[model samples]
Target: MRIGFVGGGKVATAFGRYLHAHGLAVSNYYDRHEDKLSHACRLTGAHPCQSAAEVAKMSDMVLITTRDDQIEGVCRDLADHGVIRKDHLVGHMSGAHPSLILHDAARQGAAIFSLHPLQAFAEEEKALADLPGTYFSIEGTDPRLASVEEIMAKTGNRFFRLLPEHKRLYHLSACIFSNYLVTLMACGLEALSHSGIHPEDGFPAMMPLIQGTIDNIARLGPPKSLTGPIARGDVTTIEAHLTAMADPSLASLRQFYAFMGLKTLDLAIEDVLQDPLKANALKKVLEMG
Candidate 1:
């Protein structure tokens, strides 16, 4: 299907380029940023449109890749211009918002859809090339959804449905996995820094181990996938971690350690071979913070 992109920003540009690469026509590109529009056109070999209406005028599918706050304005503009029609398929890449956010498009007779990639987009070029392997959260009604999923599958990405009402929860789960994993790594780096390890040297040192843990999680499943101090129920080791980081310089680290330990105790109760006394002791220590 011919796809028209309504924003030349990172997600729109990358996704447009990917569709083009897969022999799909990224028929038109539009953006407020002239440079981004030019760049998108350059990369996708697509024509640049002066406005969203110009884009909608030429394509069967329209992807609104604007910022979360801007989606409504863009849709309103499309509605005002009478640019959308029943034959069009409208989608957005936002995760926090559900497909219902595009109600203006729906009112204009377009089929509404939402597709959110479960990966970060640090660079446009890299995102475009890597998107084919990413997982996407998709939600819509019936044959439109089925068709979109088929197209997504052709890009070598996995697509799964989410109920509109559950979109926030689904997106929050990804945020914990992707965003909080970065936070977890930063904490690890800080703890290592207390031992005189530079952040620069620390990341490379931890990279293999971190990647291996992730691979193991993929292979072994959660709970069973867990390892280290908490998994082993090594209270002494965990205590040492807390005690070592109790100084003022590591106040945040101490707090986080306590919070994670509390959560870990819960995991241990579910997954570990635990003595009642030992579990109660671990719970007490973690709760003391």
Candidate 2:
């Protein structure tokens, strides 16, 4: 099938280049930003289009790769232009949105869907390299969902289907895994600063530990990989941590640590073998802050 793009940004450009590599027809790149359109067209070997409606008119499928906030409005614009055919497929790459966000296109008799890659898209070059191992989550009309699966399969990607009702939960986990992980790392940097360690020295020092944890998690999963104070129910060690962060300026950091510890404590109790009394005592220590 000929795939066209409505917004030639990172996702659009990456997918176009990735798909084109897999022997699929990719063309009709479109974006309000002329540079983006040219960039996508250059990388994908696609023809740049004058307008979004022109892209929809020219391809069998139109992927709206704009920001999440703009996807529904872009679909409405295509619908208003009355260009999408009854058999054409319309989709967006927003992880948080349900396929129903494309109702405007669906109203015009096009099949609409959502396709999200479970990876970060920082650079087109990196995205292309990452796409091969990336999994996709798809949701849409059941009959039309097969097309998405076909694309996943043809591009050597594995994917799972999701119900619209579960999309928010799935996306929320992604937000925590990606965005909140970065926040947690920043918190570690702050902790180092209190001890007079420069962020430059601290960040590099933490890299190996961060990578080791990731490796452990990949092999044993989070619950089984956990090995910190909470996992061992080491109440005295945990108490020392809390006491050290008692300064007024460190209140926020202390609170964050306590909050995360309580959550981690639950995981430790459920998944790790530990003395019941020690676990209870550790819980109390974490709760005290």
Candidate 3:
């Protein structure tokens, strides 16, 4: 199917480039930013459309990869242009929004879908390289499911259907897994800075351990992969950590440690190899902190 892109941002460029590379037709692209639209068209070998209406007119399907807040406005604009119709399929790439955001286009008789790739797109080139193994969360009418599947297949990706009501929770989980991990890493680097290790030096040093932990998680899963003071049921070590974090400068970290310690203690209790009594003692220490 011929595809057009509404917003020529990183995600639009990534998807368009991948689709083009995989032999899909990317017919046109449009964005408020002329440079980005021109770049995306160049990257995808698509015609540069002057307006969203032109994009809709030229393609069988349109991908609205605008920022989340702009999605509804873009859809409304497309509807106002009188371009969306029964023969067209439209979708957006916002993880936080469901297909319902495209109600304006649907009302105009287009099949609307939310097709979110469950991967971070920090940069266009990296995103294009990383797109193949990505998993997409799809939600929409059954009539358009096959088109979505075909796109996923051509991109060498997998997808699962989501209920409209579940979209927010799914996006929340994604935020925790992806965005919060970066926050957590920043917290780790900050803690290291307290020990006189600069962030640049500390980050690279911590990567191996971080990678190993991720590898363990991939191999064995959460509770089974956990290994640390709490996992070992070392109440004294946990108590020491809490005490160290109690300084005014580290107060927030103290709470963070305590919360994570409590969770770790739960995992330790579930571990067949851990002593439940020691795990309970760790929990008591965390609670006391």
Tens digits of per-residue lDDT for model 2, 68-177: 99999989988999998899899989999998999988888888888999999998789889999999998886487688788888998999788888888999999999
What digit string (tens of lDDT, one per residue) describes model 3 on residues 1-289?
A: 8899989999999989998999999999998899998899888899999888899999999989888999999999989989898888998999999989989998988888899999989898998888888899988865766888888877778898988889999999999999989989988988899889999999999999999999988999887888877777777887887777778989888788788778767776776336768867877888887
Candidate 2 positional error at 129, Å: 1.8
Most accurate candidate by TM-score: 2
Candidate 2: misplaced stretches above 4 Å? Answer: none
Error of 3 at 7 (Å): 0.8
Clashing residue pairs in candidate 3 are none
TM-score ranking, best first:
2, 3, 1
Steric clash pairs (candidate 2): none
lDDT (Cα) of model 2: 0.89
Error of 1 at 68 (Å): 1.3
Over all chains combined, what TM-score does candidate 2 have? 0.96
The candidate that achieves the highest lDDT relative to the unseen native structure: 2
In the range 207-277, model 1's lDDT, one tens digit per residue, is: 99988988987997667767787777677887787788777988888899899888877876777636777
